[model samples]
Target: MSAFDPVLSADTVDQILHLYATRGDDHYGEDVSQREHAEQCAYHARIDGADDALIIAALLHDIGHLLHKFGEDAADRGIDTRHERIGSGWLARCLPPSVSEPIALHVAAKRYLATINPSYLKGLSAASLQSFLLQGGLMDAEEMTAFLAHPAHQAALDLRRYDELGKIVGADMPAFDSYAPMIRALIMKDAR
Candidate 1:
């Protein structure tokens, strides 16, 4: 069964949690599981004083990887998977643009950063490096200019930074449930 209903409800939070609890152990070419990466990213966002919406965005940023049937190693086989679009589309059913837009643009933010800061490219993980190529390699001046005009540009970049830092093998982080209240509140607020 799918993790989410076609419409939003109280169970929406549970469905997301169930996804993390069940398939979150799958890796995305990193040492940590999907759940671990999410929690750690969220932890960093919270510590960095991100607003609740951005924190939730950080937590669910990579959810596209979990939502799809593509094996965790899709990037290894030279497939882009487009998890950012998938995740953002799925999340837009209930989440505000504040959350979903950042999730959608995070990969773009990566490309933007790597284009402007060559050293940023050196810091990407092996898996991220592969996917980066598949995700358009680098942004030219035109692309960078367009990316800069996006209202969510800064937030997306912030989430991308947290994403890079979230892949530790073992880091102290809160569990998914710890953020459920925030998630639920966001959902309810958006639904209204």
Candidate 2:
């Protein structure tokens, strides 16, 4: 069954989240469930004073990881899975570009981060580093200038940071339902 309809009602959001109730980045070496990571990212975004839109984006950023039936170790098997694009495309139907844009661009943001700062590469977790290599190591010279100018560049980078930070295990935070108001309101007023 589809977790969401043409428009995202609150109930559908919960159904979508159910995909996370059972799994997350476990095979990728993260200790948190998908639900926890989403909650953590949203919580951090809220604390960082992001507006409701970005917070909702953060909360739902990795929902693609849940929707696909990829093996937990898909990256290990050399499958990129392209969760960013999948999640963003699925979300674009119900979310504004303010949210879906960041979700779509975050992986590119990681590649962008690696190009600008070598130290940033050092900070990536094992699985992240592995996927980074698969996604594209560093942007080439011409790509560098263009990537820097992308309008979604900054939001993608910010979401990437939250994506990494949200993986910490065993944290207590509000559940998915806690953001229902934001989720309900921030969805595209006109469904795409």
Best by TM-score: 1
State how far residue 79 of model 2 sits from its true place (Å).
0.7
Q: Where does model 1 exceed 4 Å of error?
A: 1-7
Question: What is candidate 1's TM-score against the reference?
Answer: 0.94
**How accurate locally, in lDDT, is each candidate?**
0.89, 0.77
Prediction 1 global C-alpha lDDT: 0.89
The 10-residue segment with the lowest total lDDT in model 2:
1-10
Model 2 residue runs over 4 Å out of place are 1-14, 22-28, 188-192
Encode model 1's per-residue lDDT on 89-158: one tens digit a residue: 9888777889999999999999999998999999888899999999999999999999999999999999
lDDT of 2 by residue, 1-192 (tens): 233355355555666656655564444347777788888898888888887778988998887777777767778789888898889888776667788888888888888888889999999888789999888788888877776788877887888877888887788898876787777676535343
TM-score for each candidate, following the candidate numbering = 0.94, 0.87
lDDT for 108 in candidate 2 is 85
Q: Which residue pairs clash within candidate 1?
A: none
